[model samples]
Target: MKKLLTLSAIAASFVAPAMAAEEVNVYSYRQPFLVEPMFNEFTKETGIKVNVKFAKKGLAEKLQQEGEYSPADVVLTTDISRLAELTDKDVVQAVDSEVINANVPAQYRDKENEWFALTLRTRNVYSSRDRVGKLGNDFDYIDLANAEYKGKICTRSGKHPYNVSLVSSMIAHHGEAETKEWLEGVKANLARKPQGNDRAQVKAISEGLCDLSLGNSYYLGKMVNDKEQKAWADAVYINFPNQNTTGTHVNVSGMAMAKYSPNKDNALKLMEFLTGDKAQQMYAEVNYEYPVKEGVKRSELVASWGDFKADKISLDEIAEYHGAAIKLLDEVKFDL
Candidate 1:
């Protein structure tokens, strides 16, 4: 009976860990198709089930309202502005994982360790290959505001989060007064009313409606890979601006640990695991983005575009000045 009791205890101990690995809930802005494969792979490897709630808007407000009662263990979003908004609202907790710290570069992660970038995308300018005759070798955001480019440039609405962040970064570097002036200059240069997403702006360039427009680096990759999009992608030359100065203006799709997470340990494990080699590679290849992990190779599409400098500014700063940037954009009447 003694030996049987001992054996039973050993069996129970082994079973406990399996039972402990329950499910983790995630709130993500990324579409389900974009992330489900990764989630499936994670479950197969770790035996942890994932439940995700996805929406294009208002996930932040939902998390904020739920407060401590929120069942969400992790929050994922694209772009620095939204991630920073979550940090400001205190919806996320500061995490200090050595794996995350080592994998994500300083510029890409929150200064306080509240969030970490999983992948990077550059905000670049695309110009018709034939019209530009080899787009300027080095251009920065400031260059777009140059008087020469006025009435020749095109972009999406300034209210767009991506453009707002770009304007915000300009404020960080040039101060509000100068940034506002730059906004006016960019506005004056608009070929037509700012309309459409980044991809649409590239389409405009391809159609000869505009000479140049602002776009995200990865969108070009997506275009290049698709038969219909290939012509637009092939028609333009992508210019990584600010390489000689602040490097390229880059943004990220990142993740954070929810403050009210019931499964904190598992959440941290998932965070660290996502920042690891396997997950980083998956993110980069699937999205055509630059990996946050140092030394990870960019997608062949990204690599073919050539290397450039990336801004070393902390992304949180860009988020912090977002309101001011928006105000400046409004003052300049950046209709696009």
Candidate 2:
């Protein structure tokens, strides 16, 4: 999710005032320089015109083969299982908008408003501050299936849709037979076979091979503005797991509308100007994320990675337990 926002910089076009007879095409699976400075400040405050296209996988089957002649009046994505796979393929469209319901948070949108959730990420615990210092945060996630952290955890593909939306919120807080015996004790706490891409499990715990991993707090603000991963994100410790019950399991970065949105009133005024407050503070200063609205401040490197409490279930009740969290990660082969 870093480096890939350039298709000639999304064919350069912001058109703030001079010639915008209203517009809003977007299809973004979020990348064009992390949402083109909030669609160039929502086309410099309502001159409309905001036509992005970026992709990182068939923009939902190209909006189901351009249905309704898809010039796409908004569709953007990122987890909540691609907004429940574009609402089980109906391809989005409900938006009632009380200014995006007073700036999102009906458990991060889409109880029928189709989809909204602008930003907020979490799937934390990256530890390893030189062999778990800072009291190693006593890192919970049910201690990655305790057995005293067997093999010392590390992950990536428990059918990744961000670890199957955190194993479908641990099957909406422990259900599928204790979430399949807690995903076979988190796949027997793997340190090796479950390879790469959560900053390669924080560069495999800054190269001691493993000491826990399962990232996505804006990839530690893209590895503190990476320069070859800033010493593997300064050898870890991002923590934030279940602050004593059901919290810390957030997810989102949404938007939806294109079920034939021939610019539905400029795509409902660009989804109520991206949930107001200056496009949620440029989605927290150019996408470090965590702005599901309410008082939007947090991107001074995601408020220095602090504060917790988020998992009150209902990401539409954990996207209805994502096919029983991908069939309990294929009955616990969890990236074997």
lDDT of all predictions: 0.86, 0.82
lDDT of 1 by residue, 243-297 (tens): 7787778889999999999988878888888888888788778888888898877
Best by lDDT: 1
**RMSD, every candidate, angstroms:** 4.1, 17.8
Model 2: residues with Cα > 4 Å off, grouped in runs? 1-20, 25-34, 41-48, 51-72, 80-82, 89-125, 132-143, 150-179, 184-213, 222-233, 237-257, 264-323, 326-336
**TM-scores of the models, in the order given:** 0.92, 0.35
Query: Residue by residue across 1-336, what tens digits does model 2's lDDT show?
Result: 334566545544544332547788988888888888888878888878798888887787889998888889888888889888898889788888788888887888878888878887888888789897542333557678888778888888888898888888887787889878878987887867887688888888889887878888888788779898889888887888877777789888798888898878888888888888888887888768888889878778788777777777778888888888898888778787
What's model 1's lDDT at 328? Answer: 85
The per-residue C-alpha lDDT of model 2 at residue 128 equals 87
